[model samples]
Target chain A: MNSTKGEKIFYGINYFVLLLIGLTCVLPLVHVLAMSFSDKHAIASGAVSLWPVNFDSSGYSALFDETPIFKAFRNSLIITVVGTALNVLFTVLAAYPLSKRYFIGRRFYSLAVVFTMLFTAGLIPNYLLLKSLGLLNSYGALWLPGLVSVWNLMILRSFFEGLPEELEEAARIDGSSEWRLLSQIILPLSGPVIAAISLFYGVTHWNAFMNVLIYINDTNRQNLTVLVQQLIQNQSFMQEMANTQPEMAAKLTPEGVKAAGVIVMTLPMLVLYPFLQKYFVKGAMIGAVKG
Target chain B: MSKALPPPASAITNPSQEQARTRSNWLVRKYGKRVLKQNVPLYLMFLPIMIFFLVFKYYPMTGLVIAFKKYSFLKGIWGSPSAGLHSFQMIFNNDQMIKIIWNTFKLSGLSILIGFPLPIILALLLNEVRKMIFKRFIQTFVYLPHFLNWVIVGGIVVTVFSQNETGVINHVVKWLTGSTFPFLYNETSWTSIFIASGVWKEAGWSAIIYLAALTTIDQSLYEAASIDGANKWQQTIRITIPAIMPTVIIMLILKIGHLMELGFDQVFVLQNDAVSNVAEVISTFMYKIGIQQANFSLATAMGLFESIVGLVLVLTANSIARRFGQGLW
Candidate 1:
C-alpha cells in the first residue's frame, strides 16, 4: 500500500492528465449551456465561455414560444415510450422461447435471429421496403424495422436461460400456462436484466434520428434530436424561425436559440443520467459474459 | 429436491444435437399434440416475433436483389427487369467510386487507429488511481458524451470549430495566429474534426469494457508481483496487460469487422458541400442517390458491396482471432 516517491510523482501526473481529459469531455457542453442563458449582445461579442454573461431567459422563452420545439419534444416522448414498450415486449417474447431448453425449433429460431445480426439489408433496401409497405412518414417505419435489437435480445435471452429451471417446472406442475409463468414467476425474477434492456431500448428510441430522417418526411413527426440538428445546422430552417417570429428572432440570436434547443433535447437524458449510469455499466458488463 | 434438472442451454443448443433433432421430427411429434397443446401460448407469443423478423429483416434482405435489377416503382421489385451486372458496373466504373471507397477506409482506419487504444489507456490510468471517488467522478464526465446522439455531438463539433466569432477554438486560434481556420469546410480540417469528435464521444463508453476486464484480474497476482519488487510499471507491463489481452484482441477484431460502417449520422450531419469530397462515405452517398435521387438500383448495389465486405472482414477477423484463442464466434 505504500507508494514510492517515483510512483507518487507518476500518480500525480496521471491524475492531472485524466482530469484534463475529463474536463475536455464536459466543458463543451458547459459552454453550450452558458450560451443558452447569455444575452444576445454578450454572445455576439464572444463574452460567453462557460458562464452566462448578462444572464437572460429570453432564448428559452423564444425557443418554446417561437418554435415547434415543444411539438418535437412531445413526438420524441411518444416515440421513446411506445417504441421502448414494444421493443421490451418483443425482446422478452423472443428471448423466452429461445431460452427454453425443450422448446421446439428453438435452435433454429435462435440462429434465425442471430443471422440478422451478422448481416442486414442495409439502408437503401430497408428504406425501399418501408416505402413499399406504406410505412414511410409513419411512426411504424421507425418502430417496425427495429422491433427487437439482436444485441438486446441476446442479453435478455442469456439472462432468461440462466434462471433455475425448477421455478418454471414447478409452475408447470400447477397447470400454469406459459404466459402466466413468464408474467408471474419469470419476469419478476428478471427485473435487473429487463431494466437494463429497457434502458438500452429507451435510449435508442429517444435518440432516434436516421430512421426519422429517412422515414418521416412530415416536419411535424420529427423528434427533438432532428429538430435540434435543424435548428443548429439548417440555414433555411433558421430563416423559417426568423420569419415565424420576427420580433423574437431580432431579440434572440440564432446561436442562443440553437444552444437552448440543444439543452432542451439533452435535459431529459441529463436528469435520468444518474440512473442510466448505474444500470448501463451493469448491462455492458453483462455483455462481457459470452452469450 | 428429487426433481431432475433439465439440460442447460449450452447443452441443448449444440449445433450437432439441433441438427439431429431436426432429422428426427418423429421425436417432436411423439410428444406432439399434447406438447403442442401445452406450448400453444409459447408459440403464440413467438409468432409475432417471427412475423417481425420475416417482414422486417428477411424481407428487406430479399429486397437487396434490387441491386441487380433495373428497379422501377411502377414495375415493382419482382416485375423489374434484370440488369445483370449493370448497377455494380456503374459503381466500379464511376471515377467517384474509388474515391468514395478510399474515403470510407481512410476515415474508418483513422478512427480505429486513434480511437481503439484510447479507452484501454484510460482504463489503465483509472486503475492506477487509488481514490475511488476521483475515478468515479472522471468516469461520469467521460461517459457523458456517449449518451448524446451523434447529431448533438456533431452540433457541438460545429459550434466549437466554426470560423465565426462564436466558435470557441477558432476564436482562440484567431487570437494567436491572426486568422481563423475553416475547420468544417476544409477537407483536411474536416477529417481531423470528424475523428476527434468521434473519439471524444465514444472513448469513455468504450473504456467500460476494459475496466470490466481489469476487475477480473486477481488482486493476489498484483500483490505477489509487488512483493517480488515489481514496481507499478513492471506489474502493468507483465501481469495486467497479459490478463486483458484477450478482451483487447476480441474488441480489435470487432472494430476491424465494422470498418465499412463509418456511421451515416455522423458523416451526414457534419458534412457540407465544401467537404463533400472527403466526407462522402458510402452510407451518405447511398442515402442521397437512393432516397433523394431515386437511383435505387445503383444505391442498392453499393449497399450490397458494403455488406459483403463487412461480412468478409468479420469472418477474416474471427479466424485471425481464433489463432490466438480469442475468436468471438
Candidate 2:
C-alpha cells in the first residue's frame, strides 16, 4: 500500500484541517472552564478568556451554598435515573413482541409506534393532558408523558429482529414462557443495544427543560437545566440579588456564577461521554442506517 | 380491533365453494377464538406500550380540536364554544405573521443550505486521513457538542458573542477593528450566529452518517478509478460522490421535511426581544401565544398550521425522493 507524493500531500492537508476543526469545538469549552474559575472582579473586568485570571473558588462556593441549585441537581438526577429505567423497560417490552414474526397485529402495533415519530400533539395539548391528569408539578410530569420513545423503540426493534430465532426457540422448548424468554435469554444477549438506547434516554431525561418549564411551577420540582437557563438568561436577577444583599454581590458576579452553573450542569454529560462514546456511535449508526 | 383479525384458515383451504361458505362461518369463530387464546401472552406484553401511546400520543391528537374552539379552562375542550376558524384568521391577519414566516424560512433555508454540506465535506476529509487514532480523536472532539443541550450551548454563545468587552469575539473584534459587533442583537449577525452555532453543534454528529455511508463504498471502485488514472479529487467527484448519493438524498429529504420545526429549543434559547424580528420562528411563536398568553386556540392553530406544512413537505419530499430512486420508505 505505497502512496504517491500527491496522496501524501493530500493526507497532510486533511490532518491539519481536521485538527483545526477539532480545536474550534474544544476551545469554547476551555474558555468557559477558564471563566468559571477566574476571580469575580477579574471576570467583571473582562480579563479571562482561555485561562483563569486572578483565580478564585468563590463562584463554586456560592453555587454550593445555594440550596435551590442542589435541589434542582437532585431533581435532574432522579428524573434521569427513573426516567431512563422506565424508557428502557417500555422499549424492550414493546420491541421484543413487535420483533416476533408470530406476534399478532405486529404491523399494526409498529405503525402505531412509528406514527408518533413523524407527528406529535405539539406542546399545548401535551401540557393540557398532564395538567388534567393532575401530574403537573410532580415527578410524573417529567417522565410519564415520554415513558416510551418511538425512536428508541424502532432502534431496539431493529436490533431484536437481527437476533437469532433459534435461541428463542430453544428457550421455548425448555418450557420458558414469553416473559421468561425475554428476561432470561433475550435481554442478556441485548446488552449493547440496550446500553446505547439507555444512554439516549438518559441524556434526554437529563437535558429535559421544556417539559419542566411548562409543567413544573414549583421551584423545588425543577431540573438543573431550567435553573441554569434562568441563571444565564436573567442577568437582571444578579443585579436584583445585589440590591437585596450588597455584601454577597462582591463574591459572585453574574458572568462568573453563570459560567459555574454551565459547568456544573454540563460536567455529568462530559464525564459520561468518553465511556459511552463507542456505544453512542454504534447505536447512532444503527439508527441512522436502519431508521 | 376485531376487524383486524384474520379470516378462518378453512376459508382459504376449502375445495368446494358451496360447502366452504357454510363451514366458513363456524370456522371463523373457532379460528378467531383460538388465535386470541394463543396470542394472549404476546398481547399482554404489548399492553403497557399500547396504553402509553393511547394516553399520551393519540389522546392529544384528539385534543387538536382545541384549535377550532375558544379553549376556555372552565368549560373544557368539549364544552368550549366553536370559533369556526377564528384562530386561523387571527394568525393569518396578525401583523407579525409575515416577519415570523419570513424569518422561519430564512433561518431554516440557510441552515439546510450550509449545515447539510459541511458534514459530507468533513466526512470526506476524515476518510482521506490515513491514521486511525488521529481520525478517531477528531471525531471524538467533534461529536462532543451534539450531546450538549441548547441551554449550555446558548450560555456559551452568549459568553462568546456578548456585546460586553468580556465576550471573546467582541474582544477580538474590538482589538482588530477598534469596534465591536452586536452578534446577538442585530438581524443579519443574529441569523449568521444562529446558523454558525447550529453548524458547530451538529456538523460532527451529522458527519457520522456520511462516514458510515462512506464505509459501505467499495474500495475496489477507488482502485479501479486509480488504474484509470483518476486522481484523488476526480475519484471523489465521480465515484465517492455517486456511491453515497442515495444516502445524501435521503438525509436531505428528511431535513427538508423538518423545515418548519427550526428546533424549538435552539431558537427559543437564542431568541431575545431585540432580535425578535429575525429570530421569532413558528414553534417559539406558538409557545408564546399558547403557553405564555393562554391563547390556546391561536397557539393550537399555529401548531396545526406548522404540522400540516411539515406533513405536506415530507410527503412531497418522500415522493420526489422515490422518483429519483432514493425514497425513505
Comparing only chain B with the true structure, the TM-scores of all models are 0.89, 0.89
Please state what fraction of the native interface contacts candidate 1 reproduces: 0.70
How much is B107 displaced in model 1, in angstroms?
Answer: 0.9
Could you tell me which 10 consecutive residues in candidate 2 chain B have the lowest summed lDDT? B30-39
Candidate 1 Cα errors over 4 Å, as ranges? A240-245, B1-25, B28-40
Docking class of 1: medium
Give one digit per residue, the lDDT tens place, for model 2 in B1-329: 66787889967877787686667666557557655554778788888988999999999988899999999999988899999999888878887976787788889999999999999999999999888999999999999999999999999999888898878788889999999888899989998999999999999999999999999988998899899999999999999999889889989988998898888889988999999988999888877778889989888888888778887898899999999889987
Predicted model with the maximum DockQ: 2
B286 Cα displacement, candidate 1 (Å): 0.7
Q: Each candidate's iRMS in angstroms?
A: 1.6, 1.5
What stretches of model 2 exceed 4 Å from their correct place? B1-38
> Candidate 1 at residue B100, lDDT?
93
lDDT of 1 by residue, B1-329 (tens): 99999989876667986778775686656667667666677898899999999988998998888999999989988899999999988988988987898899999999999999999999999988889999999999999999999888877777777778788888888899988888889989899989999999999999999999999999999899988999888999999999999999988988998899889999988999998899999989998988889999999999999999998898899999898788887
- In terms of lDDT, model 2 sits at 0.87
Candidate 2, RMSD to the unseen true structure: 4.7
